[model samples]
Target chain A: MQAQDLTTEVAGLSVHLLRGGEGDPAVVLHHSTGPIGWVPFHDELAQRFAVHAVDLPGYGRSDRPSWARHPRDLAILLNRALEQLEMDGVTLIGAGFGGFVAAEMAAMTDARLRSLVLVGAAGIQPAEGEILDQMVLKEEFYVQKSFRDEESFRAFYGEDETGELADLWDFSREMTARVTWRPYMFDRRLPHILATVRTPTLLVWGEEDRVIPRSCAELYARALPNAQLEIVPEAGHVAEYEQPETVARLIAEHVGSLA
Target chain B: MFISYFTERPYQDEQGEYINTLDLAKSNADYNPVLGGDLYHRYLDEKVYAEEMGFDGLVLNEHHSMPACMGGVINVEASILARITKRARIVLAGNVLPIWDDPLWLAETLAMIDVISRGRLVCGWVRGTGRESVTHNTPSPYNWERYQEAHDLIMKAWTEPGPFRWEGEHFDYRYVNPWPRPLQQPPPIWIPGSLSKATVKWAAERQFPYLMLATEHEPTKRSFEYYDACAREAGHETGSQHRGYLFKVHVDETEELAEQTARKFLQGPSNPFLEGNQGQVRGFMQNLPGMNSRTEVLPTIETWAPAVARGAQRQHKKILEKKKMAKGKDRDYSGSYEEQIAKYTIIAGTPDQVVEKIRNVLEYLRPGIIAIWDGDGAMSHEDTMRALRLLGEEVIPRVREIGKELDLHSPFEVSPVTNKPVAEAVGVG
Candidate 1:
């Protein structure tokens, strides 16, 4: 299935998303590195479910809502977008920075959210380790760190000789800097607020996830009332990006069980 | 001409083994307070001595989380200078506006400095480098907007009879009143810039003296001309008094001694921001997203607009020049000593040679105000004092003579704010 590029207005913002697949709806919110088109994972997930890969405001081709300054603001906007798109009974999956936004949405309203899957999400502060500051490291090095193994990283990003990928990464990082600069990626009150969210949650973590600490997934599991933590070995921060087939199998099982 | 003494007041120490300049601010492990305290006192002493040596202004600037400049909070140093220095304008060139969440404090503190200095304050504002946004945790995207708002807020807080509420987009206050207002009625405002055309235009529109930091001579001239054009468009007459030039210059009794001492400017921790340090360009930190819109990388020299350049022609030229820069040629200053001398970015010689070099700059740029940047990097206290002595006793007198011959009058001689002679403005010939 070929992913079709589409745009939907959410609270006056032109949100860019890629739509492909069949069956139940699974909305994919991109990581802080920004959306890099529909990848192999999106295709795999598309086989079982209708995957909607979204570029959050200030990211990709989406019209940036200049007024929005926090993940919570993005969450409210996304919830409104889902409502506008008439997407109910949705399985919301978010990775990295997007995961933070997804968790916020789930906490705010479970109206359209049927199930939640957070992969190495950054919202709740980790007890043991800190979220790696993206600004401190070079864009190329930072993206490379996202995967556990060399082959996994090269497979997804390829050898970027032209610095085009680096430019995209920088553009995305700017958006990340805009919203998440002050308190960084985590919300102080998110842990408490997330406890009240009754949405069935599945927390996925790359065993070697270096960006957002692996302990963050454990924290998210603790925060959510109905959530289970699954640690995938030989994977990094974006486990879905690295081990797509395994992550897709896990998501399929989680969503299938929910149905 | 209004001449000032300037320095980064750098902490002289060996750089860490693991860190580059981009990482130096956060990752540098080689910082000692004992050395820092001594250096701070030493810098203050140099400023005091610069005033004693007859510098018209004692210029100080601010930077954060970096060893390049220990003047983390310039107002703090300015307050101390206010008490110590009897004369010489406390030229803040200047405070980083965007990082200050509460500019009310800035207003109050500056007001106090003016009060203490008995009105010898030339206030300046800068949109700080991207490192500031990162270290201070300010939103980089809103840096320019915040800088503008903060500038407007501060101006209003100073000029307008207060207790008036300020409801700005970035900042707001219920009570916009501060005690002990600045003695200089709104104080003489100056804007210093290197490359950003927006800043140069903004300064020109306000009729503020646009102090050009160490830029290539040709670009500096072009920038001044651009400022002139901008000022003209704003319906103001501009002269040399409306522009200023700052460059690294050292004078000693002997040429060899001068060059040796001046070479110390490149001795400190590698600073990406400093021209001579030539640190690796960490594009992400330097070119923060919204902070710089033109390109998402290091601005190449020649392609990058100088302290001066103007209009649609300049823009077209820049576009062509930028294409050249994109090819990864002449990316930045090499920070080599020979290159520094060749580009005239650094001038180090005997009193005669230094004066001659100063004349060349004066003739080229025709700036009313000139800031002799010295005492930076690892130059010792003695070296700085000797250089100041030569500057005050020899170079300054010659420059003053040239200033008259070349018709260069500083803001004091000719008010930049009014475009009228200061004597006329004050009703005294």
Candidate 2:
């Protein structure tokens, strides 16, 4: 199913969005590298739910929120965007930096969210290892490290030698740097704040994820009042991108349980 | 012309074997601070002698987490110069502004230096490289904004009656006052640049002298022309006083000796700043996410500008090309060294020959201040002293005469800040 492009105005700022499929509403907040339009994960989710993929403020075609200096700030803006769209009781699926935003939003207020799914999220600091610093690593290398292996990454991005997508990647990284500098990907207060969140949260992690470590999953599980950790084997950071079918099934199961 | 002596104060001990793969800025497994202490003293001694030799100014700069420039905490050395040197202007060309968490401390320190030196301080500022952001952990994206804000904060602290509050985009302070304001009101503020047109335009608009840091002759000229146009647009009459050039020139009794000693520019610590130095900087580390994106110009490290990005790509490309050429062997890229010499990146000759070359540069750029960047890489103390002596006795006098002939007056002669003569300068101060 092809996604239809939509532009939603949230408090004078234009937010780029993609809508597809049918049934209950599910908002897909993309990673820091920005939105990947209608991927296998989105397509699979779209089979049962109306998938609404959004490019957070300062990413993709969305207007930059100049005052934004942290993921919590973006979380506030995303909350407003969801409120403006009138998206209530929706499954909020966030990946990478977007997951941090998702957690922050949930912590702030979960009135808009029915259930929350965070894949390879970066909010709570991992106790064992680091959330790979994308700032220092080369852009290509950073992209490569996000997948399970070479074949999986290549199957998705395929050499990318033309550098045609470099500007988009750079813009997204700029947004990431603006928001996630100093404390890096994780928020120090997020774990404590998340204890107040009552939303049914499903924390997804790739067993072989090299970006945000698996320990972060345990930390997230411990932080949320109502949360479950699901580890997908034979996948990396963005397991939804690598093993889309499995991730979709897990999400479906979780949502079904919530119903 | 205001002739100043400068150096990167290279550590002079990094082994040649690790030049290709290891980025010395990030790793310090081979660093020895014991020897570093000795080298520091040696560089300080050279600066003192530079003053004794009659150089109008002594230029100093700061770089972090790198052996290429040993002046990581240059204000300490500047303070030392303020005490030891009695004649020369202690030009900090300058402190890396954006990385400083509290610019007030810098304002206070510089004020103390100026008062101590009796108004012989030419306070300059640098935006610094991406490596600075990584090493200092200063946000790279806000590097330029922080630089501007820090500058504004420092300037206000220096000139205005403070105890005022400052709330900026990057910095927020409730109490914004520093004691001991500078003797020269605000000192002679200079903005040195190379490739970034945005910086040149900014400096020109403010009528601050923009010193081109060891850039090629034609590009430097074009930059000055751009500055002139910008100055005109900003309703200011522009000349040499608004322009300066940092050129690498070594003078000796014989041409061969001068060239040989100056050729050591690439022989010391492997520096990414110097061409054909067999040094390698990681592309990602140098071009950290927000380092260049803030600026309007191209983001490479060529032309060695303090501003964001452009020339770095060329340097990285050279390293990669060297990798390709030395695929099976341990050969070096000798072509870049020859190219540097041909391009006058490193000009070295007999006193007369060097003077003639300076005349050519004077005729070409007509910069009021020509800072001689020497005493760097692995050159011996004796060689550096001799070069300084030749520069002070033979080169500077001739250049001063040429300066008058060409009507090239420095910001000291005609202040770029106030457009008034600095009543007392150099030795008088």
Candidate 3:
């Protein structure tokens, strides 16, 4: 299905969301690269549930608001966005840096979110390996670290013929920095907040995810009030693009089992 | 023109191979403190001699876990300079403005320095480079906002009768009072900028003298032009007194020795003090995102002159044309030491030759205050002192005359600060 563009203004800033599919409401939160619009993973989800793939304010097509200084600030904006869009009991699925935003949203008081799914999420300071400092990583080195499926990874960016598009890819990363550059990526308060998460949550990991440490997956699963963990084998940080069928099947199963 | 002597107070020289082999992926550790202890005293001695050399100001700066400077806590260095240097204006070319969780402490420290220095303190509030974000563990995105808010709070603490409650988005203080008010009314605030429109605009709005740090002449003119536009918009007139410039320089009896002395400026004198834009950050950690803004990105692209966007465009076209040549046929950026001298990025030679190079910079840039980085890289303490002595005897005397001929005035000569009452308020600090 061709994704339809939807924009909603909050506080004089417009947020871009790519909406498609017809079923229960779901919001797909993109990684630090932000969304370049409906990848194959989102396409897979659109087959089962209505997915609102976001280019959160400050990322991609969305207006980057300076007032959104902290992770919780982005969460509050997302919550308001959900409310304004009138999508109650929506399933929030976040990936990588977007997973950090999702964690914040899920941890909030009286959150409108029905369930949560974090994919190679970055929020908790892992007790083990360090999260790769994304801002400083060169594109060539990052591509190597990002995917076990290098062929698929190259194909993803290979779509952009113009250097302009490649540079535009960095803007999302810039927005991610604005959102999560400080305290590195994890909010110290997040572990406590995750403990208070009122809804069930899902933590998914790529077996070979090189960007965020695997220990982070274990940390999230242990911290959340009601959460389960899933590791997709032979995949990297962008697990969906890597193992789209496996990742999408897991999400579908989680959504089906959502009480 | 207001002349100051500045140095990064580089650590004891070490083999560059350690840094070259070291993985930036793992990051760098702090320089050995044992070595720092010796270098600190030697640098302090250099500043003490600079005042005696008739420099109008003595400058210092700070960085953390970085090999370039031992000024991790610059206020401490400023305190030392304040006590030792008598006449020269002790300018801290900024306390990395945002890193301070408490600007009140900064207010107190600068206030004390002002009293100690006898009203000779030019507080340069700066938004430090992006590397500071990693080293200091401060937020990178809000660096500008924090710098602005922190400056506002500190200014209030200094000028406004404080003990007043203050609240802002970044900072909140109840009973905002600072004891030992500054010896200079609000102390002269100068801002050193790398290349940011926001900073130029902010500096202009407050009439704060904007100092461009070791930048090319054409870009300095463009930045000053930007500042002038902003100042005019803010309903003020801007001139040389409203701007400042800093550059590395060395002078000896002859051109050969001076040229050799200036080699430290290449690839920078130290490893980590290496400029971020020149392939350093990209080579190491492109993953560390969000420190750069649109303005920060444009400056390197635009070159020394924002107004010369067309010139930059032409330059880029030429570079592209060169790139299209057979792989080995392109321009080699690694020019000879003679080329660097001709570029005027570093001023070196006998006193007369140095003066001529400086005059070219002065005519082109038109900064109100010019800071001489007399020491950089492997420049020894004795050599720095020698440079200072030459400036005192030959360079400064001629520069002052040139300043007169050009109608250039230092900030002190132009903007009248309320230092008298502030001085009187501090009876005997």
Instruction: Please report, in order, the local distance difference test score of every candidate based on alpha carbons.
Output: 0.82, 0.81, 0.74
Count residue pairs with overlapping backbones in model 2: 11
- Model 1 pairs whose backbones collide: B222-B308, B222-B309, B223-B308, B223-B309
Reference contacts preserved by each model: 0.68, 0.77, 0.71
**lDDT of candidate 3 over A60-169, digit per residue (tens):** 88888877767778788888889889888788999888899888888875467778899999998988988887655654456557787668678666755554554555
Q: For candidate 3, write residues B67-185 as lDDT tens digits.
A: 55678888898898888877889888888888788888889999999999899988888766545666666766667788889998988899898579988988998888898999887
- lDDT by residue (B161-216, candidate 1, tens digit) is 98899898889899989997999878988898776777888889988899988777
Candidates 1 and 2 compared: the better one by DockQ is 2
Q: Note the DockQ of each predicted structure.
A: 0.57, 0.77, 0.57
Using DockQ as the measure, the top candidate is 2
Worst ten-residue run, lDDT, model 1 chain B? B305-314
lDDT tens readout by residue for model 2, A1-259: 7789988887689999999999789988888888767788999999889999998988888999877889988888888888888888889999988899999989989898899999999988889988899887877788889998888889987866665456567668888999898799998899998889999999999988999988898999998989999999999987989999999999999999988
Sort all candidates by lDDT, best to worst: 1, 2, 3
Task: Tell me the lDDT of model 2 at B72.
Answer: 89
Instruction: Give, for candidate 3 chain A, the lowest lDDT window spanning 10 residues.
Output: A159-168
Interface RMSD of each: 1.5, 1.1, 2.9
Error of 3 at A1 (Å): 2.2
